[model samples]
Target chain A: MIGRLNHVAIAVPDLAAATATYRDTLGAKVSAPQDEPDHGVTVVFVELPNTKIELLHPLGEGSPIAAFLERNPAGGIHHLCYEVADILAARDQLEAEGARVLGDGEPKIGAHGKPVLFLHPKDFLGSLIELEQV
Target chain B: MIGRLNHVAIAVPDLAAATATYRDTLGAKVSAPQDEPDHGVTVVFVELPNTKIELLHPLGEGSPIAAFLERNPAGGIHHLCYEVADILAARDQLEAEGARVLGDGEPKIGAHGKPVLFLHPKDFLGSLIELEQV
Candidate 1:
């Protein structure tokens, strides 16, 4: 089952613009941009008191965010993440219930340096759902 | 400033199916459906330890969720809601920073009985943002 809302990721065409909106415009604390090659994204974290907003930009031509941006023309809400105490248990439980986990059903290290898995958008009502172990 | 993440809303074409997915499949605690005639949405809240997931469906012919579902065909993440300590102060600050608040720049009572205002998706890197008074 899902735990806390970990982070909401927004895909943006320009990472710097997105970062500035949160940092300068909103006056929120933001982390320096970090390239996540594995995820094919360069992300900046906008920290809030209770949760963080992840600004994602495509890192390469094959980046998933690139594809999303192509279809959307503009960046949009990319994914919603939840924390789980035991990811394997959660994955198994979700798998047994007929939910499809993305990427060979194995956990990958996420931006937060935690084991994370993405569930197929179709299974999650057209919204990509990520589960991270915290 | 954005406070806690109040909820992440998903627009679902079929509210019953979406509710069953979270309740029966994920074993999440979900609330009964409530209709907001003014907003033209019928929503159900999935309670989590740290945040909530709002399952939204079209309540009338003019419901915005209807348009989103028409384009998406499948339900997807609609928007993210954050809590604010002072709605008016947050509004003024956001406005001063050039972020356009949607719906005449006034806070309306949301499902949680809180005054809430929506920010333009275009100014937010394509993600609709809702600020709610806590």
Candidate 2:
């Protein structure tokens, strides 16, 4: 079951501009950009009182977000991550309910270094959902 | 300054289906659908530990989300709402920094009955941002 609303990921064409808007324009505490080559993204964390907003930019060739960026040139909300207590259990339950889990139905280490699994957008009202074990 | 992330609004074509997915599939506490004729939306609130996820469906003629649903028939993340201490001051400062506030640059009563203003998506990397005075 989903616990906390982990973080909202926004894939942006320009990371600096997105970071500046959140940091300066919105006056939020934003972290320095960190390159996650494994995940194929450069992420900047905007810390909020209750949750986090992650600004993501494609990092290298064949980046996961590159295709998303192409479809959304101006960038958009990519996915919503929710904390789960048990990744494997959650996956099993979701699969049983006929909800498709992405990536071979296996949990992978996410950007936050937590075991995470992505659910198919088709089963989730076109909203990509990431379930992270916290 | 942005404080808490009040809620993330997801525009959906089918409110009942979306609510069922969040409540049963995702195992989150979801509220009953509340029709807001004034806002032209019927919303179901998924209450998370940190914040809320609002599932919106077009309510009446000229519904704001009608166009969005037409574009994304399966539904999608519509906007993000962040709480602010002083909305007028926040708007003034954002405008000063060249961030275009949506509408007539005046805060209106949002779904939660709080003063809120929407920022232009162009000035925010294609993400519609709502600032609500808390």
Candidate 3:
């Protein structure tokens, strides 16, 4: 079962503009851009009182977000991450319930260096969901 | 300044299926459907530990989410709502920074009965943003 809302990832075409919009325009504390080469994206963390908003931009060739940005040139909300106590157990339960786990159905070390798995968007009302073990 | 993330609104094509997905599949505490004739959408709140996920379905002839659903039949993330200390001040600051507020730039009573204003997606990295006074 999901515990807390970990973060909402928004894929943006221009990382600097997105960061400025959140920091200067919206008056939120934003972190410097951090490149997650393994994840094929650069991310900026927008810190809120309760949760985080991750601004993502494509990095390197075949970046995961490149296709998403192509579809939504202005960028858009990419995925929602929720914290789970035991990700393996959660994955098993979700699988048993006929939910498709993405990417070989294995938990990979996520951006935060925690085990995480992504669920199929089709199975989740067209929204991509990530489950991270906390 | 934006404080807490009020909620993430997801517009779903099928309210019942989306509710079941959150309650039964994801195992989150979901509220009963509430019809908001004024907002032209029926909503279900999926409660998480820190924030809420609002599931919206079109209701009435000119529902705001109707076109969104038409573009994304499987449903999708519609917008992100952030809590602000002073709605008017937030609006003024955002506008001063050249960010366009949706509608007439006046705060409307949101579904939660709080003064809320929507920012244009173009100014917010292609994502709809709602600012609620808290």
Candidate 4:
């Protein structure tokens, strides 16, 4: 079963500008930024009471974040994450149910070092779903 | 600060079918249904651990949900809600920051009897944000 909401990911064209807006304007404290070389994306997290807001920016030209920005010019919500008891188990369940997993076999370190796996939006009615193990 | 994620609202063409999918397919328990005459929407709530999923269907042809469904035929996510300490205070802050509130004046009882208000998508980039008070 899915637990609490882990975070909401937002795809942004400019990470610095988005971080500044979330921090200065929304009063959300920005966490240390991290880069995922495999995904070719950089992410920063803003912690809230029971969830966080993840800001994602493309690291290179051909990254998925870049494609997402191209598709959504206004820089909108990318995905919704829910905490799970076990990342691999959730991945297996989703895969068995014909959901496409973005990453390879294993779960990877997501924002705030949480073990995370993403299920493709096509399988979930246009809403990207992420499972994170806390 | 926001307490937790109150719910994620999805706009669907068929409320009964959506409720069935959430209950049988996803194993989520469906809450009692409610209708908002002012918004022209009939909604069903699916309760999770910390957050609920709201399936919104239009009551009339000219309703906002109808317009949203017309814009996205496949049935997409509509809004993300955050639980606030005080709905009115959050609404006031958002309004002072130039965010447009769709409803007039006071907070009304939303799904599950929570006082709620919606911030227009135009005010928050392209994502619709709802503030709910528990």
Off by over 4 Å in 4: A95-115, B1-3, B103-109, B112-115
Query: Which segments of candidate 1 are over 4 A away from where they belong?
Result: none
Go through the candidates in order and give the C-alpha RMSD of each one to the true structure.
1.8, 0.7, 0.7, 3.1
lDDT per residue (tens digit) for residues A23-83 in model 2: 9988999999999999999999999989999999999999988999999999999999999
Instruction: Name the better of 3 and 4 by DockQ.
Output: 3
lDDT of 4: 0.75
Model 2 agreement with the true structure over B1-134: per-residue lDDT tens digits? 89999999999998889999999999999998999998999999999998999999999899999999999999999999999999999999999999999889989999999999999998988899999999
Candidate 1 lDDT, B1-134, residue by residue in tens: 66678888999988899999989877789999999888899999999887889999999788877878888889888888888889999899989888899878888998778899999999988888888998
Per-model C-alpha lDDT, please?
0.87, 0.94, 0.95, 0.75
Decide which is better by TM-score, 2 or 4.
2
Cα shift from native, residue A114, model 2 (Å) = 1.2
Sort by lDDT, best first: 3, 2, 1, 4
Q: Sort by DockQ, best first.
A: 3, 2, 1, 4
Least accurate 10 contiguous residues by lDDT in model 2 chain B: B122-131
Worst ten-residue run, lDDT, model 1 chain A?
A20-29
Per-model TM values vs. the true structure = 0.93, 0.99, 0.99, 0.81
